[model samples]
Target: MSHDILRRHLRDLIDAYNFAQWLKTLKGLIPNEFICKRWTSEPNGFIITPIDQIPGLNT
Candidate 1:
């Protein structure tokens, strides 16, 4: 495998292994876990409406 592929794979695997070993050390968002991360990366222009704006969610 190419160096780039090996590097990325190794990074993700290492982070996963470390996170599992010390899960209690993580109190916030988990590393390599991406959702807002995806939204931040793409090229788009949609106002990130606050979750509080959802009429039913607040109810």
Candidate 2:
């Protein structure tokens, strides 16, 4: 329902699907600075950080 909730759900799905690795792969293929900038900017806007950077994920 709400936009914020929907975004969170989507983000959770992405995380569940291991989308960060996909993003990194896509970024590598594209070789665009703007894409890299956009990817890095997302966490500041959404409270979502990379799963790999999370403490529990590394364990």
Candidate 3:
């Protein structure tokens, strides 16, 4: 892809990643019951809960 196109795609990816991180943070601020079930979904660079799990947190 051309540099301009690559840069635009990267910018969009970054925006999406940033939005996901913001959503995660927003979820943390809200009550568990009120939060969306999808809050646990992974962001590009954000790790909410690990695959191996953190014992009580993931359980």
Candidate 4:
């Protein structure tokens, strides 16, 4: 999705995906796992972990 489209639809998308709370909870997580395993092949970088893995995700 385009940045503009993503920006405009963020709220709707979050609600539709049932990820609003997940996103909020993940905000504090540490980067332990890769968001995508293949992401490691990229020159840039990527990271992922369970939302509950975050320091305060359960709060």
Q: Highest TM-score among the candidates is held by which one?
A: 3
lDDT of 4 by residue, 24-45 (tens): 5556342344443334466365
lDDT of 2 by residue, 1-59 (tens): 89999999999998967766765777645334444456587756545444444345445
Against the unseen true structure, what C-alpha lDDT does each candidate score? Answer: 0.59, 0.63, 0.59, 0.54
lDDT (Cα) of model 2: 0.63
How many backbone collisions does model 1 have? 0
lDDT of 2 at 55: 44
lDDT of 4 at 58: 65
Candidate 3, superposed: residue stretches over 4 Å from native: 28-59
Candidate 1, 1-59: lDDT as tens digits: 99999999999999988877665554445543333444467626437633333346555
Please give the range of 10 consecutive residues that has the lowest summed lDDT in model 1.
30-39
Clash number by candidate, in order: 0, 0, 0, 1
- The RMSD (Cα, Å) of candidate 2 is 13.2
What lDDT tens digits, residue by residue, belong to model 3 across residues 3-58? 99999999999999988887687774533423333445533443553334334664
